[model samples]
Target: MVLANIQQGEKESLRSYTNRFFAAAAEMEDVNPTVAIPNYRRGLISGDLSKSLQLVKPKSFPELMARASQFMLLEDTGNGAPDV
Candidate 1:
């Protein structure tokens, strides 16, 4: 299957970018986590969650997602804004 390139828009939020990434990734018949994880990280704009994930080194996609979810929650709470 042909997968479209994933990109993070300048004004896009992390949640939006992640949703787009997953949508594109789902189009691939054989999504390899090993490749997907790095690609996901590469597409993200440099930020706290990305840095934290790099340091933690998640072993699987689920772990990486969990970290992202936690970060999103923290970000939302810290900013006092509802997740978009």
Candidate 2:
């Protein structure tokens, strides 16, 4: 729907759709630790940062920390260099 709205030159509609998607995401009551963290990350990258933070905050701090640590090594090689 977002892509369709964009293709149709409906910028306002696209924004509304994006906001709706974020709102729906926010209303999720529960989610898997592994899946939810990644879902939140994707939301952040896609302009739903508040929603991402919402998902992150309800999780155990240690779990969040573990995800953060894993994020740091997502593209690790023996070269000991940053992926990005």
Candidate 3:
């Protein structure tokens, strides 16, 4: 929660956020990487891509997108999503 608030408030401060994230990770009410990871996964399944991406900011955008893609429907070359 502390780190989240810091990140939420200081959107321009990555170094501070990284420090606070680790510092607060152990004490967060429910902000452990494990919990955040699954929320991110569910967000993808639910088509809430923004929330999913916010949960895990990978070093690169492509890697982050690829992580989200694991939970996305594998679209056909024709851009059709097959029946679930």
- When sorted by lDDT, best at the front, the candidate numbers are 1, 3, 2
Candidate 2 residue pairs in clash (backbone atoms < 3 Å): none
Off by over 4 Å in 3: 2-11, 28-31, 37-84
The TM-score between candidate 1 and the true structure equals 0.79
Question: How high is the lDDT of residue 4 in model 3?
Answer: 30
How badly does each model clash, as a count of residue pairs?
A: 0, 0, 0
lDDT, candidate 3, at 5: 40
Q: What would the per-residue lDDT of candidate 2 be over residues 7-69, giving only the tens digit for each residue?
A: 212332323433454455456656345554444344333322334345455365355544444
Clashing pairs in 3: none
lDDT tens digits by residue: candidate 3, 1-84: 533343322232223433344455556665556445333333232333445456555554346446545434333132433232
Cα error of candidate 2 at position 71, Å: 14
Find the candidate with the highest lDDT and give its number.
1
The candidate that wins on TM-score is: 1
lDDT per residue, candidate 1, 1-84, as tens digits?
Answer: 223357678888778887788888877787888888888887888878767767767778788778778767776577632322
TM-score of 3: 0.29
How far off is residue 51 in model 1, in Å?
0.7
Error of 1 at 56 (Å): 1.7
